[model samples]
Target: MAETPAADVHPPYLYPDYKSTRLRAPAQPLVRVAPSPLDTAGPTFPKHFVKDSEADLTTWGKSAPLGEKMVLVGRVLDEDGRPVRRSLVEVWQANASGKYPHPVDDHEAPLDPNFLGKGQVLTDDKGRYRIVTVKPGAYPWQNHAFGWRPAHIHFSLFGNAYAQRLITQMFFPGDPLLAIDPIFQSVPEAGRRLLIADLDLEHGVEGVALGYRFDMVLRGPRATPMGV
Candidate 1:
């Protein structure tokens, strides 16, 4: 496994201390076994985990959610810059009001009955995927004094199977709260910009919604930082 720098982690004092003291040194690398016939064929995965690639989160319920509609489009690529087709990409986020559709989220913001804030899609032959969803709102957190989380979406990419996975978060470009958000700040300064998606007018449909492009490189020097 790749080792993330210790400085890139959230400060121990900001979060719970119980797990902080239990941290240990990195484990030794294990000896590799030669690939068998099954390993040589690579991972065989099921298709259409969430039905199709035209997933629209805002229209999940009886009506569309009240918020700014946005279109997210991106491609998944390997370290060598080749497209990774047939991969599964999943995402979830808080509603436009900064409230989650879960019991544990006790934020005072009102929930959107129409918005479930979850979507999934399978990449095409060209490794491209698209989603239509509302922009999530920033919310407060207890990680620091006057702490506030930036509007973002959680992404889980499955390259081949359960063992080959990369989890991360996507933030909007030019978010002022990112500087103070401990989770976003946990990433090293050099690679932190990779997490922010760029505005893409070319892929965006005029008048309907704005668009953001967030291409991901699974591994390499340009690889996006994965969640630990």
Candidate 2:
């Protein structure tokens, strides 16, 4: 009989901690539960929903979501540099007003009745996906005396299986708040560049929406530093 090998752990410096010196890192589950029959033989990769691959944050209701219209596009690739096709990608972000459409958000900004601030899309055969949304505004936080979070969008990706899922936040390239935001600083400086989306007019529609390209590499030497 052969023994099992140890798992590869993520780099610690990349993840943020409220009190890293005192608090211990997350512990891996004791048992590796095998996928159940339902999970192993699920319907399709992603079950069809009312809006499975709709990435436009605007146009949910009678009017479009407010703010600067921009296009977000990216490719999903595995550690081996192979594309992960048909992966489900989901994104949630604050409106241009820097407020979410949730009760927990106490920001003074007014919410757009038409903007739900959530969307989902699937990667195509080339491992590419795109979404159209407004640039989220920076919001104040209570972390410090005058804490504020940089404009960012939360992203979730699911590969062929749930175990291959990945989650991260995408930031704009020139956000001034990046220097002061502790959450953005959590990632090691070397890996921080991977989180910022770049401006790419090539991917944008002519005079329609500005384009930002954010590629994600799941695991390995080029893995995007995931938030703790």
Candidate 3:
């Protein structure tokens, strides 16, 4: 049995700064359960299930979604520094106006009729994935008086089995709100930097869109912090 690494790169479940965590974090120690054969052997997604076009969120609508268009590209790697090929990567984000299309989002910003704000793609043989999307906008939240969330994109990744799922968020470079946002502050200072993507001019399509790179390490001392 391999020992689980210390969750030094992950955020605490009960980070007081993130007020909601206080109400939901387990008060008791988590119980451990051995995985059954079923838990470790299934839940695979077929490549055809996710069409290549599904990876581009900006093209889904009848017309271009309004916002700064950008491309996000990166690789998914395991703790051993090897690619986790063909993994499923899903992303969701608020529209350019900082409003989600869901009914629960009461933010006054107008939703983009051309942008559903969600997309998914399977990593290639080298664990590389790409997404074309508009840069999300900052939105007001009730976490604190005059609170607002920084622009960010939510990411969900799944390994060969359901047990290998991980969820996190990606932010852009030099976002001012990041310093004051409680959710972003929950992670340790060292791990916090991993959540921010880097601007990569080489990946940018000339005059088409800017490019950002955000790689995710599944686990290890250098693992990217899990948002949840």
Give the poorly placed runs of model 3, Cα more than 4 Å off: 1-5, 33-39, 220-228
Tens digits of lDDT, candidate 2, 22-80: 24554443454455543332224544652643777777868877788899999998767
Q: For candidate 3, lDDT tens digit of each residue in 1-228?
A: 111234466677777778898788877665556655554544678879899998899998899999999999999987777787888999999999999999889899998899999999998889899999999999998888889999999999886554567899999899999988989898878789999999987797999999999999875222432221
TM-score of each: 0.79, 0.79, 0.90
Candidate 1: deviation at residue 56, Å? 1.2
Predicted candidate 2, C-alpha RMSD = 6.3
Give the number of the best model, judged by lDDT: 3
For candidate 1, what's the RMSD?
5.6
Question: Across residues 1-228, which tens digit of lDDT does each residue of candidate 1 receive?
Answer: 324333352222233322332344333443444433433233545774467634789777888798888999999887667777888888999999899999999889999999989888888898898999989999987655677889999998876433346788999999999887766765667668879999997777799888999998665222323221
Better of 1 and 2 by lDDT: 2
Off by over 4 Å in 2: 1-44, 50-53, 220-228
| Residue 215 alpha-carbon offset, candidate 2, angstroms | 0.5
Model 1 lDDT, full chain set: 0.74
Give each prediction's root-mean-square deviation over alpha carbons. 5.6, 6.3, 4.6
